[model samples]
Target: MKLSSEQIKQKLKDAGLRVTPQRHAILEAVYTLGNHPSAEQVIDFIRVRYPGIATGTVYNVLDVMVESGLVKRVKTDKDAMRYDAIMNRHHHIYCAESDRIEDYFDEELDELLQAYFRKKKLQDFKIEDIILQIKGNFNDNSE
Candidate 1:
């Protein structure tokens, strides 16, 4: 979901966060790049147009955004943390070799997992979210 600067500001305001130029640029960079990006990737993107923005500033902005529910933090099996712009419920397909991530949404799979867990009925544990990371290599030439 691409958002204009004004819309991004409004989103931040709605989330009870102050809208700043750095935050706006960071959010815009994440939105523009649909693929899950690491902190360094975000910094590189922001630096192209926002040369003055510091790497630390980008990381801080991302942390605030994730905490405020404006973005999501995806953790791969390899322990690498990636930032996702889309807040909606979804899974990911992670490419091990390239460290690329792609969104995946499957209603049936979600329902199956929910039903299985409900039947199992683990005590004292609550499932907040389920994000499956299917690890593999992305075939670029094959559809």
Candidate 2:
């Protein structure tokens, strides 16, 4: 999902964020990387293009973008916070060995979860989001 610079500007504008070069570079780095990356990784990427950008600026930009619903922050089992560019509904598969995260989606699983929760009928509790982190080892030979 490669977004053009114009599209990135539109996204920032829509989120009520000032579209600056640093913000654009940070967003592009996250989107292009696809995989959930930590703030440090984002900073490293931005440094290549915008040499003067500070690490703290990247962190601030990510926080603002997430607060504005432009990006999502994912917490892995190991307790590392990773930022995701995709904001849609989906689950994740975390590889224990490599500490890698992969997106997972299934209509059947979604429906099952919804139905199960509806039947349970917890009192006064609302489910804001459902993100399943299936921990497993990577099967390199299978592929």
Off by over 4 Å in 1: 77-80, 141-143
TM-score of each: 0.89, 0.91
lDDT, model 1: 0.86
Per-model C-alpha lDDT, please?
0.86, 0.87
**Which ranges in model 2 have alpha carbons more than 4 Å from their true place?**
141-143
- Which window of 10 residues has the lowest lDDT sum in candidate 1? 134-143
Cα lDDT of model 2 by residue, 47-104, tens digit: 8877899878888999999999999998876665799988878899888667788988
- Where does candidate 1 clash, by residue pair? none
What is candidate 1's lDDT per residue for 7-84, written digit by digit as tens? 888989999998888999899888987788888888888888889998789888999999999999988766657889
Candidate 1 local lDDT, residue 137: 85
Instruction: Kindly give the stretch of ten consecutive residues in candidate 2 with the minimal lDDT sum.
Output: 134-143
